[model samples]
Target: MLEAAKAVFITSGVDAPAKEIADLAGVGVGTLYRHFPQRSDLVKAVFQREVDACVAAGPALSANHAPGTALTEWIDRYTEFLATKRGLATALHSGDPALEALPAYFMERVGPTLGALLDAAAASGEIRADVTPRDLLLAVAGLCAPVDHEGAAFSRRMVAFLMDGLRYGAVPPEPRG
Candidate 1:
């Protein structure tokens, strides 16, 4: 049901009817309500579900690919997750105390996973060692924000450019002539 809620929230915003999520989940509205009890409850569950999925991807990616490739792929995943997260962000900032812990949860869970990846990439000479995971996370979050007249592709290109900049520092400096 959380998956259904996430899909509906991503496409239709958090105010979308509970029936839509129930239908997508192949359950009755009663079932959804019984589990979540309130719209805020549903929203919180969905957000946590998605965040957990994104965090879980880090280890699988690191295991399957080289450090640089894993980092880039993880960034792409983060971009997609962020794109779907704007609606949830609205819910979190809606003056509801229930939603307050989510931001901290996101940072605490994601920061270390990203740091591990960054550490591997830097140690392997695939990116600069000077970059902190927190800084990179904020930069990506800013880049992922939708700008007027620009779209995801533009943000992606900008992020790719940032990746290229990181790679630049990985290159050894030329010896003085």
Candidate 2:
């Protein structure tokens, strides 16, 4: 049923009707409503799945590759996720009462998971000490700052630059006060 919602949302936007979700799931409307009483609940569930998948990838990537390479690969995957997420973000931020809380929910779930990965990479000496998961999040958000149409390749390049700076300590040192 959640998968149905995800498909509908992805193809038709979060505003896709509950009936459409139920039809896609081969479930009754009552069943859909029973599982997710509100439209926001359905949307949140769909978004959560994507977030969970990306978060889960972090540990798997780190386990399979050297720390620096793993972190680099993970950031690349994250940038891709953010590209898709621009649509989700737009839907969530549409001022619709139904999606009002989704932003906070997304951050709460995804932030800490990425934090763990970033910490692990730092401990392995793969990235600089000043790097934070939130900083990475913000950087991805910045990469997505341009218009969404042709922004994907552009954002990925920005992510590459950001990751390079992170790995090599590109920022100038501050003078002691």
Candidate 3:
């Protein structure tokens, strides 16, 4: 049900009706309500699920691919994750105490995972050593912020440029005269 809600939310915004989520989940609205008594409950669940998936991808990606490739792919995935998250930002910041902790939660869950990826790439000499996980994550978030169906290509180009910058000094600079 949370997965269904996530898909619907991506398409229809977090303000999407419960019935729409239930219909997509192939369940009745009552079931959705029974599980999540409040809309915030449902939204929180979807947000947590997305966070978990993005964090888990880091290790799996690193294990399967080269450090540079994994980091690049992970950044792309992180951008996609951020796109979904933007939909939930309003509700997550709605002055509800329960939702108030989410930004910290996001950093806690995602920061170390991204840090590990950054460390791996730097250790492998594939990217610069100066870039911190928080810095890279913020850069990706900024590039992906204005994301829409039309702006996705522009976002990709921006991310690619960021990635190139990350690799700018993978080899030593030429000696100056």
Candidate 4:
């Protein structure tokens, strides 16, 4: 049901009807309601699920791919995850108390995962050691959240540029003495 709701939310916005979600899930509205009694409940659950999935990918990606490749692909996957959040943006800012903790949860879980990725990449000398996970996370989030009517392509291109920057001068900065 959460997966169906996520798809529906991505395609139709968070305001999409519960019936649509229920239909996609092949479940009755009653069933959907039984699990997630409120829209906020459903939204929160879907967001948490997506976050978990994204964070979980980091380890598997590091294990399966080269350090640089894993870092790159994980960021791309993170971009897609960010795209999904576009639909939820409105609801998130609607001052819904239930949704208030989502941003914190996102940072708490995603930050550590990204930190692990960065650490591995730095250890392998695949990227600059000076880069911090929090900085990278904020940078990507800022880039992924398009502005001035910009499209996904622009965000993606900018992210690629950022990745290049990370690769450039892949060494720690000189001491500030």
Task: Report residue 161 deviation for candidate 3 (angstroms).
Answer: 1.4
Q: Between which residue pairs do clashes occur in model 3? A: none
Q: Give the winner by lDDT.
A: 4
C-alpha-based local distance difference test score of model 1:
0.88
User: What does candidate 3's lDDT look like per residue over 42-90, in tens digits?
Assistant: 8888898899899999999999999999999999888888778877877
Cα lDDT of model 4 by residue, 42-74, tens digit: 999989998999999999999999888999999
Q: For model 3, how big is the CA root-mean-square deviation?
A: 3.8
Q: What is the C-alpha RMSD, rounded to one decimal, of candidate 1?
A: 3.3
Compose the digit string of candidate 2's lDDT tens values, residues 37-135. 977777677777777887888889878987678778877877766655654666787787877876787688778877877777677666787877778
Which residue pairs in candidate 2 collide?
A: none
Clashes of 3: 0
Q: List TM-score per model, in order.
A: 0.91, 0.73, 0.91, 0.90
Q: Is candidate 1 or candidate 3 better by TM-score?
A: 1
lDDT of 3 at 110: 93
The Cα local distance difference test for each model comes to 0.88, 0.75, 0.87, 0.90
RMSD of 4: 3.8
TM-score of 4: 0.90
Better of 1 and 4 by lDDT: 4
lDDT of 3 at 113: 95
> How many clashes in each structure?
0, 0, 0, 0
Tell me the spans in candidate 1 whose CA falls farther than 4 Å from its real position.
171-177
Model 3 misplacement above 4 A: 147-149, 171-177
